[model samples]
Target chain A: MKKYLKYVVILLLIPLLIIAGACFYPERSYAFVSLIAVLLSCVPFFLSFEKKNNSTRKIVLLAVMTALSAAGRFIFAPVPFFKPVTAMVVIAGMYFGAEFGFLTGALSAFISNFYFGQGAWTPFQMFSWGIIGFIAGLLSSPLIKSKILLIVYGALAGVFYSLMMDVWTVLWMDGYFNIERFFGAVITALPVTVKYIVSNIIFLIILVPLFEKKIERLKTKYGI
Target chain B: MNSFKNLNPYFLISYFIFVLFISIFSFNPIYLTSGMLGALSYCFLILEKKNILKSIIFYLLIFLAVAVLNPLFSHNGKTVLFFINDNRVTLEALIYGAVLALAVVEVIFWFKCFNLIFDSEKIIFLFGKISPKTALVISMTLRFIPNFIKTFRSVNTSQKLLLKNHRLKRYLNSFSAVITQSMENAVITSDSMNARGYLLKHKTFYSRFKFTPTDLFLLIISAVLFILTVIGRTSFTYYPEFIFPDLSLLNCISYFSFLVLSFIPFIFEIKEGIIWKFSVSKI
Candidate 1:
């Protein structure tokens, strides 16, 4: 079980490495660079020579998880509610570990844009989502199993998402980059931000404990 | 395809540098317009036929909007057309805005073409001389976006299933769930990568591409053009005062050549497209 877990973790790191490369090449569109990186990262899982270690099964599961996470943005969009896809990445992180959480968060946004359409903004999406998952991993302790702690972390994460998203928005938008205009932009983004925060609170309050229970059961069954 | 084949990655990089330099030192309307036209024509000829019309329409709308609005907002320039509540609407502002918009659109169009021609592999090859750590971070960031989005959705849906009413409340609950889950995943990924020696000092790419004689020739030509363009644009200024007089056959030829060079990539793509069509017809 530990060995399998180790493999799953390795699979998650591939996307982050790709993202790091794309960030350096400013000549190319961030979206294009990131997309190619995400696609290439899949090569290891699909083409790896190791067949006996249940690599295929794990790859399929990760792929499905990645794909589902990508679709979360376009299908439901979390317009006013919680960003649905972010929730799954957070949960995945809690159950899995830091690396899985990071990739799940990052790749979910990267791959989804292929269908929704790619743009200059895709990198920001990758960074924002990746950070969210990364933070969750850092915060998660054994105490994550506590119902109240889970709910609080979940709420904090939702607010974190909103803050990061807003920061990217200000960076992308011209006038908002200046301190004078920053307040106005922040005020304008407040409603959406509030919505993001509130939705996250709702998700964490209900889903954290349930997932915690499920993860505990899985760990016990697998003897991890 | 052959045109671009003769023009290597070096040419593209040099051309980009040339454009940036020219944009700073030279701000002539005529020059900017000509450059934009050259880029647009190149892109139009090279890009997929279906996309060209859409881009053209988008550009036209933006051009018109800026042209019409600039006169109202900006009261600069010598050529005045009319007055709005005693504030003069300058023809110069309108023209200048249109040209600026065109320049922006053209640059964006060329970049799109650049993206189609150069994928991640080429980028890595060109830029790998720099720090690998930075490169790896960029690469990882690129792949992370789509994957993160997917996980967010499944988690949300599962949360929704548990909460029937009070939609706002449901969202608040779900938010926390998503954050916690994603973090857990990130940790696992980090551990896995570390275990596999991903953080080692000497990392190698799995694929390889070689530079040929053709590529070298193209690079030399691009470097020369880039240097010449920079010198021509920045060496002297025969503008505003018009003391030395601006119009010269040499200047026109150089400007025209530079424009042509920008389109080489697009031309190559068009050649490939024609070949593809021919092959399909034969099949």
Candidate 2:
């Protein structure tokens, strides 16, 4: 009962702190404030809880994961092709679950947007990245361990996110929804997709084998 | 809160539909202004009743700043108020921008109230089956963000205590530490969830919501009012009368009534809070 109560308190505190942070510093860039809030909020989980053996190594791995994914968002931008973020998101989702994958994707976008700027589009970005992460988790089954399956899934996730973001743009753009405009937006997004595919190719070519090997070592070491 | 349980789900859906309809089909200044005014007044009443005046004052200042500062880059309007070098600072643009800012703030406020009223449980109840997987994913994803945030804070402070000497290094170390901690936490959480057969099958769920006859009545009324509002909007020449957006006596009364109608929910909420306070005092 006590444990359950503690979880409830923690769950409630998260949104409250984010709201307080956003409200308290309205003058500061919202994107920057949000990034800081996300970073600052994670500190409690680290100290108040314990980790398994090789915690230090695990933490380093996570940081690298965040940096790799964050860098993917900036370097690749948004596209429909095999984006860097798609690969990373899929990898994370496969390893973790849908929830963790979604967080990773959303936080990556939120932090990156600080470098970009917040607009009427922040919620959409959150939603888009969240969708990608969710798909990654849903698709991450034992059969997906093969590189071909993972890459295929990553490509599909990229297309899915691009389509969702395109729909949002159509809604926000001040005009009647016509077939011409819809197709036009999709065509405009093609270059972004190309960039995404290029980045995904680069990330997957290197990161997957390395991560898989490391996880294998850890599993053997820990007797999982 | 109990009465809120009697509010219809379709009423909520239609509310969003009306919002989208207005935003898409109509860009009339009068319609926008009426919405702005209606929303603003309700927010005012809410703040007054809840004693959130200070927060509103603070946000208003920020709103003003964002509005005034934006036009330096977007100098598009023909009606120029002044000439700063070659560029024109137009009154039309500034006012347009100020209204847009107000609309943005109002939308945010509306969503905040919506969250308070409808909340996660209600959302799950409404849209769980058609897309149960997506709903579960969203709920869990929402859960992780706050969890990550809380853990990040404590871990940073502990790291700060250990590395007390260098300021620049402290910031870098903290950033790296957060990423590391989050990854580890994610793995542990995943492992635990997996062991419980989370992803293997459809998860059974339940909600705290109950539907009553009063809810049905409220739904019908809201739907009728919405249909009427749409008809009135399409059938009448409510604006563009040439003289400074004049409101006829009847129109003025109708708008005022609309404003009052919007406040009905908040008024009930404030009254409940007062009664609860009184009861507690007596106890």
Candidate 3:
């Protein structure tokens, strides 16, 4: 029962809440639904570490990775929308496991927003980056083994993040999921989306090898 | 002697959560106006005057952009305002846009206040009650950001001294070195915590915050007000057609209750100021 907890949460509870929200409270469902999704994501994150030895190591590593991902934004500030935050998050997921990846990605967004300024979009950003990291972790074996697949995943993650955020934008603007307005938003956001994908691909190509090598070394050294 | 800022973190968190959610979900002009006024006044009371002006101006720009841009994309509603490029810009759409813009800005301002009030220590305190490890991760990540940045810069400078040309490669190499160093540091950190018996079962945690009577009273009041406001919100609609609930005694009562709910923090702040002034005069 405990082992299947994550699947139950991610698949059953979240969808039920979203459907119920949409059915009963259409006007207010977006925020409530997404907020619930974000909170639910944290369940798998915390559950993954339950009763595990060396949990301290995992937590510290996650904190470092999150901090690195957040600071990565500052390092690439000279380049517009070209930060390696997504790359760091993907690498964390690939190395640490899905739960740590999710936590790192979410925390990085939440912490970095202190510098960038928090707003209504913060939760959406957190959910997007977090889910990206979580999925990356789930596919860690293939992602770590194949360079091509890793690069492809990076690009898709960028598009996915933008798409998730665009949902928020459309919902905010139209107060509901207006398909026409949503498409308009996607079109309007195409340039930034392209930039995001390109940057992700570039950073992944550069950083993944370095991160994987270091992580492999640490794993062997500490038996993590 | 207690003030708004001195309210229990839990109460403050609940208040902000209730108000922000309410502000975002409701679109009735009355609700939006009250939310905006409440957010603006609370900000003025808390933030420095210069920051207040800057944020007000920033939100004003966003408000104008939303107001101007909405009519271009959305061509709904009955009253046509003008036609640009054969697009019928409706007055109703324009008003809806303004309301949407105001809602966005109101939420933003409330978040600004939320961020100001809920600093890192308070966040850790709140989260710590649920999970100590989670709070530890938050606090550690917060600490590591500045430390990592400093390490990155020092690594970059040292690398710069060793190599010329290929600045991109140098930067990447320096960053790679920082990654390796941070990984090693992570190991050491975990080892140290392990040595100290972290992650032990039945671990005890400590916090400085205590729930006072004032906090309990504030929480109860805010929770009741929140329920009332939510009830009030259900009968109101803004899009497609703005349908406010008919002007009945119950509707008026709920509306005023919501207004009071939104302004609770501002009321507390003003009360604090008045009490402070009176005490100083006595002195």
- Stretches off by above 4 angstroms in model 1 are A1-224, B1-12, B20-25, B45-47, B118-128, B152-182, B199-201, B233-245, B270-283
Task: Estimate the TM-score of every prediction.
Answer: 0.55, 0.51, 0.90
Candidate order, TM-score descending: 3, 1, 2
lDDT of 2 by residue, B1-283 (tens): 3444246555665654554344323434444555555554555554465555665677688678656854564465656778777877776557645654555555545544454455545565565655554344345544544454455456657878886757534433443444455555556665676677665645787755555676566556555544544443322221122124345564454444434434445554566678888888998
Query: Pairing residues by index, what is the TM-score of model 1?
Result: 0.55
Which portions of model 2 miss their true places by more than 4 Å? A1-122, A127-224, B1-25, B37-51, B58-102, B142-158, B161-203, B234-261, B270-283
The prediction achieving the highest TM-score against the true structure is 3
Across B206-280, the per-residue lDDT of candidate 3 in tens digits comes to: 777789997898889888987877765345554466565788766676677778888998998898889999999
Ranking of predictions according to DockQ: 3, 1, 2
Encode model 1's per-residue lDDT on A32-82: one tens digit a residue: 344445455433332331222323223333444465455445545545454
Residues A172-209, candidate 2, lDDT per residue (tens digit)? 33122323445767998987875665556555655566
**Candidate 3 docking band:** medium
Could you give the C-alpha RMSD of every candidate to the true structure, in order shown? Answer: 10.7, 14.4, 2.9
For residue A151, model 3's alpha carbon misses the true position, in angstroms, by 1.3
lDDT for each candidate structure = 0.55, 0.53, 0.80
Say which docking band candidate 1 falls in.
incorrect
In angstroms, the error of model 3 at B152 is 1.5
DockQ for the candidates, in order: 0.06, 0.05, 0.65
